[model samples]
Target chain A: MLTPARLAQYVLPLMVLGSTQLMASTAVDQQIEQLRARVSAHSVEVNRFEQELLHPVDTRVAVFLTLAGRNGLEVDAVELFIDGQPVASHLYSKRERNALERGGVQQLFTGNLSNGGHEIKAVISVRTAKDQFIRRESVHRFTKSTGTHRLQLALDAHAPDYEPDVTITEWK
Target chain B: MTGLFHSWVSAPAIKIFLLIALFCDPAKATSPTVPEELSEGVVRFALATGDITAALPLQDRLKGDSADYLRGRLLLESGNVQQGLDTLVQVAQGRYHRGEAALMVARHYGAEGDADESRNWYQVAAKNGFGETRQKARFALAELQRHAGRLDAAGKTLAGMDEGYWTAVGYLNLATDFARTDLNPSRALVSLRVALAMCETDTNRERSKELKSRLLVRAGQLAYAHEDYDKAIGFLKKVSLDSYRTPQALYLHGLALSEQGNYRAAMQSWHRAKKYPLAYPGVEDAWLGMGRGYDLAGYLGQAGEAFLAASAAYEGERATLRELEKRIREAGAYKSLVDDARNADLEWFLADSRTLTQPRLAYLLGLIENPVTQRAVARVAELEEMIASLEQQERDLTVFMAALGNKPSSDTQGRSKQLSADQDALTNAVAALSGPNISPAQKRHIRELRDALNASGSVLERLSNVGGGNNQRQPRKRQAERLRKQTQSLLVEVRAVRDEAGKALDRLALEFIEQEDQRMAFALDKTEQQIAHLYEYLALKKLDGGKP
Candidate 1:
């Protein structure tokens, strides 16, 4: 009773519409998830020596971080910051002359600590094997000693790569 | 010797230098303004030609009105003292970078060793800009104060530095500046410690460690002065004075060792000190230690000789040191102290050992006191007369304590107490007088001044022996105490002489060269007289018109 041609047209149009809708929905959902995960895996540490950042008269100090324990964690980048502004950043451990470097033990960067006290924050990125990246922020604090003071940063895969952004209103 | 010295002094080479200085005008001394193009051209020329004289052609044309400061500087470098000063003065009046010119003048005065004048210019320079010129002026002011032994002023000047500029060297210099102050030894030590701490983890730099050692030595000396001998020794033990730190550190270490009653070690230190130039700053103390150690060890002759050498080393510089040696030598101690003091200070301390002051003072005062202590007193007198050259050294613990009436350092209390205990020792010595009898007035004056110094001198001597604690080989500081006493007596006489000379010289000198056409000279002389008047109005102006 029905022609073969009419049946084929009607069936083909239906199949095409359904497949396109499914693909569009899947892609949109994956993109939203990726954006959320991008900031989730990263962690941060903040430390402040003084209520206000202290600047030593003429001393050289550096910020340090450790990346040993976090297996399956891929740290794409790290940012060192002072008073909310980025001072230095490392990308994929490539050879660069941004700071004075030493092997293995820890890196010493030449920069002055503010005199009274300073709050330093480390913003790091870590991505899982599945590419699930999270951003984190941690803080360390210090006061200027008549002697040298140390700042230590530890990295762990157990932490997320991204954290909610914090805004600092005042800096000294 | 005279011929060699004369040849060096009157070298024919100096004539050429003088001629050059007189005739060489800066070729590029003229410029209307420091036009960028012109300044660049001149710099290129200077750096290229390397002929400092080629800059002279611009001199008068410069008017010191344009690139005036540079012109003034060139003029000064060319030996046109007055002209440069004039041009610089005009530039300083203009609103340009004259602050730098003022500093240039200050530096000029400093090189000439006129610290006071240098300070005046530096102060004016400081008001100019907030840049390098201002910072330089501050440094110049601090240095001048330091040179004048006004340590407080130096410290105050450096206090303006923010935490950002506490360079290691600056910190060390600041410590040194504060070390010479009325502030106690502990404070000075703290200053040095602060500097040391600031050096932090920069251990790879030689300057950091080298300066630390230098600071440690200074801290040791201060602790020694403060009677914290143990602490002094502790700090001193931390470093070796291997390089340039040798003379200064080793000397202080020896002082600390002597304080600890480690005489054998102290003597060794002193012997080591002797290998350097004799006239070096701290060598006087080394001589004292050497002689005193020998005395304690019963090598009386050697002790006396060492004392004489020490006395000579600081003859005009430290009147008390010289006098102490003379007295010990004359004390009938079976050896002569004057010869040793003279040998140490004169023969060893200086490249040129001139005996004009020590021998003259001793020769004039010999046979004036009791034979028993005459040897001692003569050494004391020589030491006292030398104070003019070592004025700063005179304001030590002994002198300070004497003025303040503080207790003697623990080590010397017994000796100082015993030395003053028996009137019989003094009376017996008086009986031994072979010279003309001294009038009661002179004796009283001498006693007043000498006794006035007793407290401080005793303290100073005691400090030389105090330690963390030890006995037996507990070397006595009595030798030092006795010498110090003798030194006090000598100072009394020297002060009297200085006062007399000062008064006489204070009179007018404009009459000496009153040539009619020399009105300029006459005016200059009159100004000098006015300056003297100004000096009298002020309590302590340190005017070269005559005042140490």
Candidate 2:
């Protein structure tokens, strides 16, 4: 109902009826450009919003699997349980194992938790350089507060002895 | 059909429709497609996570027209607009999405101010595009011609575009062109009349009535300018009382009645207008006109009293305008306005004000009617939608992430078991070759087998040998991690841009309010002048012994 001409005519009296400036030709085009930018933006925001809503910062607990050193402790699979409820389990591809070998961190799990103390159990299946298939399970205790909690589950087989060990450390 | 299966999912229609609908439909038909080499589920998961970058490499694995279209879409989505446009232009040469691609290219060039290129692509789209794409291109081409002052060309472009809603829109645009150029006022009126008739008859679109009201007001204003008071009155009288246009229509109707020497009728129109809020555009003018009508009709005492009432209304409205100006300065006011405008769609300024909850905002109905303010409001509404969509996505992504590792992929499990078996075989072979119990002949036979195995280099050998120098491909897990980080970075950038746009909108809102405040101040000045003029006439009459 509020066409540009009507508003213009209402604002100024005795004006030439056709003299009200039309909306700029580029107005819709500019709006389209803005929409494109918004599309790209919203695409990114979706993930961020999902992260917040699904795993709220206050109660979010995340576990990441990373290899600490260049020891041949090839990860075959890793399973994670929070307070004895199975949350995440993945069988690794050779390519995926190489990714971890190259210092890539894989997010094992992300879930909500109650405040205070919680137990995280990580079960890792690894193939050593000696063709030994070993299954290792480790448990760590941490506190979930009003902030995001990140736990790093590392397969450390560094220099010196190069003995492969599965360890879970809470990220401060 | 395989190509169709993939291309259909990436079709511009589905994507654009999804965007418009905000993807509220839970039962989605199309999903992201990957080549047979890559996992379809992984690509879908990547897209669901908004990690388009992670899925981008899979585009290399895709081929044919579908591949080109998908590549163009991903590139465009990832902000590679130039590449995306080029790729789409290539796709435009093919049957798949040709019309859609052509239209998009036309719009891109049009936005870039390349009128010749834009027109060429628009023509291409009109010829090649099917269904809605063709119609949209024709409309856009007509608008381009209209904007360029090519009335004849524009009319020709819109000649056969008699498809109801779009046809009405076309005529309206053409009328606007004619009115702006003043090349042919009669034709402009004709076009508006035709558009008004079309709008009246249009039943599909909910906005037809709103458009009809706009057309009436425009036609009335045009007729009034041409001194066709009867025609103006006839048109203005049809404007619905509940329409946001009613105040302006009433004011114009009063002027038209007075021009025809019907002062009593004019006074009635203005008197009816006085019932509306003074902040409504032209309502204050209506108040002033009513007093003037009384004076013209020789109701001297009533004229003086009416003038006093008009001035008081103006003064009271002035204070209210100040408060609205303050309210506009706050970002919350724009947010509230955006919420009200959620269902406004294309009619940002024409949104029903009666449904508005904010008293301060309701008063700015006249101000928000400005096209500039409307555009700003529309942008804010779009931004708010983006934010809301983002929140929904975040929740959805959490579920996706949580579900990502719940089960091992069958392919991976099968491969893992095969590798373990192969490793056992290799281990047993090596032990058999080295054992002291083995005869020399048996050892040689096993050695020959071992040599044969070593020559082929089985899956177990390759997997066990981590430092093998040949494999250079980046792993999927690493790519996913990189995409996640990039997404995090993009989130920061996008948020900053959103905030900046929001601030700009706040400034525009304040400017609209301030302009309204100035307008109210001017109206108050005019009313005060009317009051003084009325008293001067009254006193002069008393001095001449016309009244005690």
Candidate 3:
């Protein structure tokens, strides 16, 4: 067991361990210098990321305007005029009430305005068993010229979520 | 005792000991109330044989009498009530473990609604120092009082707990005592609250916490009934249903939300309360609260849905005479949204259409804020519809423009000049040098007609190129002219089209304004609701236990 080969093996392992320790210490010293240089040259941009063009409230809107009542609500009557001449009204209070009550009320619109100001008026009145309330009145203007006109009509109606998945999928 | 125990299906002490063991080391998950091995075998045997007969023969080999009383209970639970009763009766009359046997027999009789028989055995067990038996005796007596409509007597009997047993259980009983009577709920709450504080261990604390939550909810109900909205809100505040199913508490919370003008929050609370499977009679009202919240908040769509659900749920439910109409009214409120949303949509759409463009954009913008603040469904619909119109108009403009690519601009100046020259010479040419062929007035009119012809020159030039332009300009121009005779009409349509490229500068300006206005409404409404909710919550809390 105490042969020259054994002594040589033990001595070689000791030498290898000593050299590795020496190398590790020098490596640590070199890394410290390199880190200092990196720190001195550091110029980082701290930018805040932003999400653009994603609007949170772009969904179509639908509402059935009515005056509150003790017994039940009443529908709003709509009268439309083009240049002071009575034009066809797409919606009247009674028609609106029946359609909305029945369901799947999607307001569709077409045709276009060739720019410039046009006036629109909306009035809502509630007639009930005991009293009547002129709930809402408004007049506004719309203008379009030269290009294609985009028109959106929304109807407010909420049914139930009890329909089967297949039925709901077919709504569109 | 063996005879009695065998007749009883098992024994009593063994069952409780097993349960205690299971409770002690919960880290070791158990398969069922019975041992896992017993469960598998029993289940298999029961399924295979369609009765307990086969299970009995195979199950007798399993060694353990620890759950003997529980075994009898299992029989009862499995719907063999008569057999279970006989087994427990035999055990009670057995020589060994007389106290446990008597307790089981008492429970069996009590379960069967045989109060007299249960009381007799309970008394015997109580005399024999069975603590649980003594409590049953008290409960039975209280029930008897309850059945007899003697609220005071029931409460007194419950309160007659021995001083040694004056734990949270006693307080809970006291709460129940108050619940069934015309007593002050606050007093009942106070009693329970004290008991909650008196809990000595985790189990007692957990139990007391639940009881306290329930008591507070009841107290809230009483206060709410007395029109003490703030007090009721406080009672339901910060209570979680993790420990106990408490619909009354949630309902009170919703009630407070509605009172505070936080209709959306109130709706949420009521909706949650409606989800509770075991609700009080007021649960129906919780559904009503959801509809009412939406109606008040102006969220017609959600309100209608809530009302309809409430109506459906409460269909054929019994109610007080006054509540009959109230229920119908709630249902009717739901029906109103159809018209409500319509009105809102039309009104909002009209306003939105006018306000979304420049010059009048700011003015129309203000009209929608209040409606949006109310969360009007129709208002939302109109906003969306109008935006869609604007967006479409912009799209069509681009498509038509693309279609008319490479078209030359028209030049109608020559015709205009010729017409103008003729108008100047019309009177000179018409007036006969020798004789007055036309009157002075007629001559002037002829000159004006020539001038009008001169004016038509430019119009003709517009027409000439309209026929030759890209993609037939005549039809489009005519369409535009039909909408309005104003000059400004031409400019808005011109800016609307877009290719695959981004929207034209003008269209962008217009569309951006419209979309931003809509987003502003939703934001404003949401913030207003939130602020109102906070204010109400704080105000109610102040009124409940502090300053208002």
TM-score, chain B, predicted structure 3: 0.37
What level of docking quality does candidate 1 show?
Answer: incorrect
Chain A of candidate 2 compared with the true chain A, TM-score: 0.72
For model 1 the local lDDT of residue A35 reads 25
Candidate 2, superposed: residue stretches over 4 Å from native: A1-172, B1-80, B130-132, B180-184, B198-203, B275-280, B339-353, B356-491
TM-score of each: 0.31, 0.55, 0.30
- Candidate 3: where is the Cα deviation over 4 Å? A1-172, B1-96, B111-113, B129-137, B150-153, B160-180, B183-187, B190-213, B241-248, B257-287, B290-548
Question: DockQ winner among the candidates?
Answer: 2
lDDT tens digits by residue: candidate 2, B1-548: 00111122233332222221221111221121222322332333333333463355455565654667667766765556878899999989987989988988887776466788888998999999887688778878887777777889888877766555556677877887788878547988999888877666656343566566778988998899888888999999998776556878989999999998899999889888777776666688898897899888888778878878887887787777666556556545565444433333346355453532333434546546565665555555555555554444444343344333233346645775686687678867676667668898987978766754553344334333422211211231233345455445545544655666667667776666677668778877887887788788778978999972
Q: Candidate 1 chain B — worst ten consecutive residues by lDDT sum?
A: B508-517
Model 3 local distance difference test score? 0.40
In the range B1-548, model 3's lDDT, one tens digit per residue, is 00111122133332322222222222221111123333333433232322332133233334344234434544443345566567666655655445665766776665445667766876665555355456545555555555556766756766664422233444555565665564556666665565545433324333435545655666676667666788778767745464232565777788876777777777777777776431132455576677667667766556556555665554423222123224324532212222232344433443422111221212122222222112222223322332343343334334333332323323333554565576557546644432467788887767665554544443344434444443344443343333222212322322221110111222332333354444434433443454455457557867899742
What's the C-alpha lDDT at position B238 in model 1?
Answer: 77
How high is the CA lDDT of each candidate model?
0.45, 0.63, 0.40
- TM-score of candidate 1 versus the correct structure, residues matched by position: 0.31
User: What would the per-residue lDDT of candidate 3 be over residues A74-102, giving only the tens digit for each residue?
Assistant: 44444434345443333343334533333
For candidate 1, what is the DockQ?
0.00
